[model samples]
Target: MTKHFTMGGTATFDFIELLGGYIVAMTGDFDGGAFARVVGEPRVQGNKTYLDMEHTFIRKDGSTIQTRDQSVLTAVEGEARLLGATTYNVVKTTGAFEGLTGQFRSWGSVDPATGQGVLRFWGSIGEASAKAA
Candidate 1:
């Protein structure tokens, strides 16, 4: 069986220059007090933008759950917003998150100017074996 989760958070990013794109280190605070950190690269080519990122969720005890996801980001014409949808796959787990494996379909937006934004995620998680079926 799968278990569902819904989380919303506000995130901030610090960007670094890259040849073909930009890299960011992101930090956030989630509704349930969980902390999030991410390392991502956003590339702009022609009229398209893409993101490759890894997300880390930290618990109070300092253990973490990690996921990797990739998606395309679309800029809202005449607005400063960019929206994206992606599936985050569990890549690592620890402590209370041990054996946790699943994917989360996440939707979010970020403002390039301030490097700040809000994100909401809703998805189901299950064992690796269970999901294979």
Candidate 2:
């Protein structure tokens, strides 16, 4: 049977450089601070831009989940805020999540200056085997 679940979190990013790309970091109260990092290359097309990224979610217990995430970010209504829709898949898991596999679909928004963002995501899991990929 497929185990379904939902997750919500907050995220932030730091600009390393244009050529070097950026590092996006996120965390939440799930499993005592489930922190995640995303590294991606940003590209623009027309009035929208997207980032093809690799994300890793690490829990305090040392369990980890990795995914290849694709996000489309657009400036919201002529404001300084940017909204995003991210779709990711579970590529790997380790430690406590060794046998786990799952994916997540999330929506987020960020501030250009502070890089802080609000995140909300939900998806289904395979079965110790869990969700939040």
Lowest lDDT block of 10, candidate 1: 19-28
Candidates in order, TM-scores: namely: 0.65, 0.69
State the lDDT of candidate 1 residue by residue for 53-125, as single tens digits: 6666665666566778776677777888778666778898777567767777667777778555555666555
The local lDDT score (0 to 100) that residue 84 gets in candidate 1 is 62
List candidate 1 stretches off by more than 4 Å: 1-47, 130-133
Local distance difference test, per candidate?
Answer: 0.59, 0.65
lDDT by residue (tens digit), candidate 2, 27-58 = 55434333344465578887578877776677
Q: lDDT at 101 for candidate 2?
A: 64
Please report how far candidate 1 places residue 68 from its true position, in Å: 1.3
